[model samples]
Target: MAFPKELYNAKFVEYIESLKILYLVDDKFKVICDDYCSSKMKTEKYKKKFEKYFQHKLEFENLSKELEDEILIYLIRKG
Candidate 1:
């Protein structure tokens, strides 16, 4: 499958190839990617709406970061 636009994030750029591979073969990784994309989209929407001080936005941002870290760790470990 084609990479989803929602999964395009600067932080994940370096891991694009690995992500694509894992996305196709690993169910858990796919879910993580989906959740990461969702959190990123929500974070952007909240940022636009609240401009930086919204609690929900912060929460989403934090979740996005945590998910990102998880992805990085998983990729590194898989290597």
Candidate 2:
């Protein structure tokens, strides 16, 4: 579940997030992101939401796969 640190950009992030893909497993499965339901910028809404929800930048934050795919990735591929 680890990739090059530099590849973790808004687009890639959004791409993976939208895939509804889950990463890591300790007890069953954990979502990596949020529902990224916004159209503008895609990641901006989540960035702000996470910042407000968790009080931090979305970049440094690790969300559930649901939120990650929903909020980060696009609809074409699964990152």
Candidate 3:
């Protein structure tokens, strides 16, 4: 399911406005904001960039979870 277009647009605009304020406050934020703005050039391309970032992050978490399970099992056996 997808969010309603109106809600999505409103939220996006709100985020952009907040980012603009952040950009004004710090010079460093301007560079990241500029990169984010440029990434919006093409729909699928931008989507892929976001997807790739989250996929890598989730993969790391999954690996951590596996290790945690292993440690718990070992501790239980030793107890």
Candidate 4:
């Protein structure tokens, strides 16, 4: 899908790349991320959630001020 070009910021891609590295090098974190993706795939609800999330977090985007704050708050609360 063509993602909107106004959703993610620099740190978002950095965080995602860090997770990718962890998924490759750390077995424990790999399991966590793998399980996260797998479990989310098991239901339509989570599928939509992941879809929307990644769509908003693609590596290239000039996110707006409001959205950047919202994403930070969401990630902080979830983390």
- Candidate 3: pairs in clash: none
Candidate 3, residues 1-79, lDDT tens digits: the string is 2222332344568586565566677768766655554554456687889999999999999999999999999999999
Writing each residue's lDDT as its tens digit, candidate 1 over 1-79 gives 7677876668879998898899999999999888887888898898788865686878999999999999999999999
Every model's TM-score? 0.54, 0.20, 0.41, 0.39
Best by TM-score: 1
Candidate 3 vs candidate 4, TM-score winner: 3
Q: Give the count of colliding residue pairs in each prediction.
A: 0, 24, 0, 0
Rank all candidate structures by their TM-score, best first, as comma-separated numbers: 1, 3, 4, 2
Error of 1 at 47 (Å): 0.7
* lDDT of model 2 at position 60: 42
| Global lDDT of each candidate | 0.86, 0.48, 0.68, 0.63
Per-residue CA lDDT of model 4 for 16-45, tens digit only, reads 657556667888976666666555456667
lDDT of 2 by residue, 2-78 (tens): 52243345776666653334433332333222223323346776778776866544534655556777765665455
Candidate scoring better on TM-score of 2 and 4? 4
